[model samples]
Target: MRLRYTTLVVDDYDAAITFFVDVLGFELVEDSPATTSTTGAAKRWVVVRPPGADTGLLLARADGERQRAAVGDQFAGRVGHFLEVDDAAAEYERLVALGVEFEGPPRVEAYGTVAVFRDVAGNRWDLLSGP
Candidate 1:
C-alpha cells in the first residue's frame, strides 16, 4: 500500500481551492460530498495534487474552534513542508508574480536550492530543487 493524502486545514474551501489550483497550479483531483456525522454542517472531500504526483493533499476546512485554531499554525510556524520542484528559481518567480507570500529570499545550500514560502493558511513550506 501507499500513502494517498495529507491534510491541510483551512478557513474556507473555495479560497483554499483557488490558491492551490490557480496560484500553485495543482490539479483538482476530487471535490465530492463528505459528512462527519448525521447531524452537522455539510462538507466536501476536497483533494488536489501536482500534475504528476502520486500523493495529494486533502484540503480540510476548519470545522470548529479547535480546528480553526490549528489553521495557519499546523507546522508550528516552521518550514515543515518541502515542495520539491524541477526549478526553484522559476517556480519562485511564478509564485511572486501571483503574489504568493514568501518568507525570505531563495538561498542555495549544499543540499539544494530552497526558498521558504507561506501557504494560504499561513503554514510554511520550502520550495527545493535537488535530491
Candidate 2:
C-alpha cells in the first residue's frame, strides 16, 4: 500500500505553514480551529501538499507537554523527513531564492544528492535527487 500522509509537530504553526506553503511551494489544504485556553493558545494544525503532488503533510500543534518533549527529543537537530526531487541542486537553489536557508549545500551521496534545510520552527528536511 502507498503511504498516505506524514505529520510534523511544530512550536509555531503559522510560521511553519508559511514556510511550507510560501517557501517550499506546498499548497495549504486545511487550517486548525483557533484555541481558547492558555494551554491551548496558539494551538493549531495545518495541512499542506507539494505542488502537483498527491501525498501531503499535516502540521500538528506541539502543545501538549508530553508531545512537545517527545518532538524535541526526536527531531532535535535532525531531519523530520526526506523528500525526493527531480534535481536536488535546482530545487535547493529555488528554495534558497525563496528565502529558505540550507544547513549544508547539496552533496552527492550513494543514492542521490542530498541537501539539508530547516522549516520555520527549525525542523530539518532533506531534499534528495537520485544520481
Candidate 3:
C-alpha cells in the first residue's frame, strides 16, 4: 500500500497553513472540520503537499501540554523530515532569499547534495538532491 500523509503537529492551524502554503510553497489540499473530540474544542483536518508530490503532510494542532511541547521537537531535535528537490543548491538559494533559516550551508555528499533547514515551527528538514 502507498503511504498518504504524515502528521506534523503545529501550534496553530492558520499559522501552519501559512508556513506550508506561503513560505514552503506547498498547496493546501484540505482544511475541513474534523470530528469533535471529548475536550469539545474546535479542530480541523488540514493537509498540505508539495507542488507535485504524491505524499502530503497532515497538520495537527497541539491540543494539550504534551502535544504543545512536541510542536517543534517532534523528532527530539533531529533532522526528522526530508524534502527531495530537483536541485539542492537552487532550492537552498531560493529558501534563503525567502528568509528561511538553515542549520548550515548545503554540502555535497557521496550520495547527493544536502542542506539542513528549519521549518517555521523549528522542525529540522533536509533539502537534498542526488548527483
Candidate 4:
C-alpha cells in the first residue's frame, strides 16, 4: 500500500501554518476547529498537504504537558520526520531563498542529497531526495 499522511507536532500553530503554506507552498487541506476543555482554553489543530500530493499533514497540538515534552525531545536534535522531494538541492535552495534557514548545506547521502532544517518552533525535518 502507498504511504498516507504524516503528523508533525508544532508549538506555534500560526507560524507553522505560514511556514508550510507561504514558504513551502503547501495548501491547507483541513482547518480544524479550535477545541476547548473544561477550563475553556482554546486549542488548535491544523492540517496541510503538499502541492499535487494526496498525503496530508496533521499539525498536532504542542501545548499540553505531554505535547510539550514530546516536542521538546524532538527539537533537542531528534528527527521527527522527513519529506521527500524531487530535487533536494533545488528545493533546499528555494527554501533558503525564501528566508528559511538551514543548519547546513545539502550533502549527498546513500539515498540522495539530504538537508536538515528547523521549523519556526525548532522542529527538525529532513528534506530528502530518494534514490
Candidate 5:
C-alpha cells in the first residue's frame, strides 16, 4: 500500500500554502472547507505535494496553544523532514535565492549530498540528492 498525506501543523494556512506552492514548487492538491473531528470547529483541508510525488502534506492550522507551540517544532528541533531532489546544489541555491534559511552549505555524505534548511514553519528539512 502507498502512503497518503502527513499532517503538518502551521500557524497560518495561506502562508503555508504560499510557501509550498510558490517557494517549494509543490502543487496545491486541495483546499476545501473542513472541521475539527473532536470539536466540530471550522477548519480547512489543505494539501500540497511535489509535482510527481505520491505523498502529499496536509497543512493543518494550529487549533490551540499546544498545537500552536508545536507548529515549528513538530520534530523537536531535529531535521525531521526530507525533500529529495535530483540536484541538491541547484535546489539549495534556488531555495536560498527564494529566502529559504539554510543551517549550513551543502555537504557530501556517504549516502548523498545534502543541506539542511528550515521550512516556512521553522521545521528543519534536508535538501537531499543521490542515493
Candidate 6:
C-alpha cells in the first residue's frame, strides 16, 4: 500500500493554503467543507502536495486550545520536515524573495546543500539538495 497524506495543524486554512500553494509551489489537491468527528464542528478538508509528489499534506485548522498551542510546534522546535529540491541554493533564494524566514543561509553539507527555513506556521523544514 502507498502512503497518502500527513496532517499539518495550522492556525488558519486559507493562510496555510496560500503559503503552501503560492509560496512553496505546492498544488492544491483538495479543499472542501468538512466537520470535526468529535463535535461535528465545521471545518475543511484541505490537501496540498508538491508538484508530482505522491504524498500530500492535509491542512487541518486548530480546533481548540491544545491544538492551537501545537500549530507551529508540532515537531517541538526541531527541523521536522525535509523538503527535497533540485537546487537548494536557487530554491532558498526564491523562498527568501517570497519573504520566507530562514534560520541561516544555505550551506554545503556532506550529503548535499542545505538550509533551514520556517513555514508560515513557524514549523522548521530543511531545504535539501542531493541524494
What are the Cα lDDT values of the candidates? 0.91, 0.79, 0.91, 0.80, 0.96, 0.96
Those runs of model 1 whose alpha carbons end farther than 4 Å from true positions after fitting are none
Of the two candidates 2 and 5, the one with more favorable TM-score, higher being better, is: 5
- Which tens-of-lDDT digit does each residue in 1-131 have in candidate 2? 77667877777778778888888878998886877476556556578998787778877777678767755345767777787889999999898888887888899989989999877766678999998
- lDDT score of residue 90 within candidate 2: 97
Task: Give the Å shift of residue 107 in candidate 6.
Answer: 0.8
Candidate 1 residue 8 Cα shift, in angstroms, is 0.5
Number of the candidate with higher TM-score, 4 or 5: 5
Model 3 lDDT per residue over 1-131, tens place: 89899999999899889988998899999999975576777899999999989899999998889899999999998999899999999989999998999988899999899999988788999999998
In candidate 6, what are the lDDT values of residues 1-131, reduced to their tens digit?
99899999999999999999999999999999999999999999999999999999999999999999999999999998889999999999999999999999999989999999999899999999994
Residues 1-131 of candidate 1: C-alpha lDDT, one tens digit per residue: 99899999999999999999999999999999888774567899999998999999999989888999999999788886789999998999999999999877779999999999998999999999984
Alpha carbon lDDT of residue 126, candidate 2? 91
Query: Candidate 6 has which clashing residue pairs, if any?
Result: none
Once fitted onto the true fold, the runs of candidate 6 whose alpha carbons sit more than 4 angstroms away are none
Q: TM-score for each prediction?
A: 0.95, 0.78, 0.94, 0.80, 0.97, 0.97
For residue 58, give model 4's deviation from the true position in Å.
1.4
Off by over 4 Å in 3: none
Between prediction 4 and prediction 6, the one with superior TM-score is: 6
lDDT agreement of model 1 with the native? 0.91
Error of 1 at 16 (Å): 0.5
Query: In model 2, where do residues sit more than 4 Å from their true spots?
Result: 32-45, 70-73
Question: Using alpha carbons, what is the TM-score of model 4?
Answer: 0.80
Better of 1 and 4 by TM-score: 1
**Model 5 agreement with the true structure over 1-131: per-residue lDDT tens digits:** 88899999999999999999999999999999999999999999999999999999999999989999998999999998899999999999999999999999999999899999998999999999995
lDDT of 4 by residue, 39-67 (tens): 65677668888888888878876767887
Query: Superposing all C-alpha atoms, what RMSD in Å does each candidate have to the true structure?
Result: 1.3, 3.2, 1.2, 2.6, 0.8, 0.8
Please estimate how well model 2 matches the true structure, expressed as its whole-model Cα lDDT: 0.79
TM-score between model 2 and native: 0.78
